[model samples]
Target: MRAAEIRLPGVAPVVVDREVPRAGDGEVVVEVVAAPVTPLDVLCAGGKSYFGVPRTPYVPGVQGVGTVDGRLVWFPTSAGMEPGDGSMAGAAVARRSDLVELPDGVDPVLVAAAGLSAVAAHMAMTWRGELVAGEQVVVLGAGGVVGQAAVQLARLAGARRVVAAARSAEARTRAAAAGADAVVALDTSDHMELVGRFLAACDGAADLVLDPLFGVPAAAAAHTLRAGGRMVTLGASAGRTCPLDAAVLYGRSLRLLGYTNKELTGAQQGEAVGVVAGAVARGELVVAHEVVELGEVTGAWERQEAGVVRGRVVLVP
Candidate 1:
């Protein structure tokens, strides 16, 4: 089997030949069709994540779209977070329970690109953020996969308006393409300026906020929320610590919640993946992505880590 191996920590993966993995009890071998180079893959492989330093010379994909027993499915692997080869190869082992059967007619590359990022966005907005129809939404980090998905999913869930904010001009453009009612720049260091921009874009206050970037963006978005509005944060790409005003919480009685895919059961993950896949199949949802051959994993991985890629990078094996 041809696979991308992370031979060293903090290094990009290189294509290498490896033995085909054999599935064990409760596991199956998925003939990987497409695998996404996600941030988790880079973080774990870098040996700097909370997951701790992973065993070296391992495959690094966390999730992929593939087939088992001729049934198309989306599967997850422990990979860089644990001692196992992952879906970045032509064949990878996955627990049967972790497989989510994708909807018919969906593109494998597209589903693989969206993968857990989309799942996180959907789950956070609906389950954790308690988003409701006819309500306004504000999405932070709207350029990333999660943000893009949230922008679209909020509308699908009946949000009256969706406001997006991102730190870069390219990101802002992507957010606009995702159907956000208004796009605001997230590049400012002044909290009040960001809050004012958000307020203006939302035309008042939002009912729900899907926040992936924390730090100033989180604090600013919080100020643009209506009384009792909910903010669900899944990642801290911008900063780990937020400078949220204490008065905002008390004055508005706002809700601040954390979300992670780790908290979801296999059933819950599968259901969310199914929803995302179905939406993609219906042409109602899409995320910007670039597909590269599995052999070019090194360059693709480097590009993604350097933040040069415009969207998710999917490796087709």
Candidate 2:
């Protein structure tokens, strides 16, 4: 079998030949159909992510869609960022509890491409963020895969208004297409100015904020949340170390919540995946993504790391 092996932390993966994974007693070996290269995978391989790196000489994908003895499933690589191998290979091992069976005939690439990014968006809004129907929701970093998914998921989750914030013109356009009622064009720098711009776009106040971009973006979004509104931080793509205004936090009685798939029980995770997958299978939610051969994992990593590639990028092994 072939895999994108990471022999050194903080370096890119190299395509290498390796033995196929074998199913353990309570695990299933998924014949890799498609896997998405995510920021988590990159951060983990860098040995700097919260979960840290594996012992090395391991595969690096975090989630994927594949089949176990021909039954299609979506599974997470429990070994990713901790130890052992991941889904960035021709075959990967997954605990049975990690597998979520898919509806019949859905596209594996589409499901795989959604991966953890989309799941975070869906769960952050509906579960963690508790976004109420007819409420206003804001998605920071709306140009990225998670942001795009968040925008659409907010609508599907019954948010009456969805506001998307991003720095790129392309992202703004993409956000609108994804079902945002309004799109706030963000500035990469200028924290205060960015805050002002975001506040102005809100018209009044927002009910929930799905924030992936921390730093200035999170702080800015925090101020726009309506009294008692919650802002869920699922990631820190823009940068960590957000500066919260003491006045804003206390004045509005705002709540800042941290979120991750790890917080969910296995059953909760399955339910969450099922909801998102149902919407996806029904075409109620979609995001733009590019497909690449798994053989080109290094180049794909570079492109994804550069942050220039718009939409989800899937690798077919």
Model 2 per-residue lDDT tens digits across residues 230-283: 999988877879888999999989999999888888888888788778878998
Q: In model 1, state the lDDT of residue 27.
A: 94
Residue 268 shift from truth in candidate 2, angstroms: 1.4
Off by over 4 Å in 2: none
Residue 287 in candidate 2 has what lDDT? 81
Please, what are the lDDT tens digits per residue for candidate 1 over residues 255-290?
999999999998999999999999998887899999
Clashes by residue pair, model 2: none
Candidate 1 clash pair list: none
Q: Best candidate per lDDT, number? A: 1
Q: Once model 1 is optimally superposed onto the true structure by TM-score, how far is the C-alpha of residue 224 displaced, in angstroms?
A: 1.3
lDDT for residue 31 in candidate 2, whole number 0-100: 93
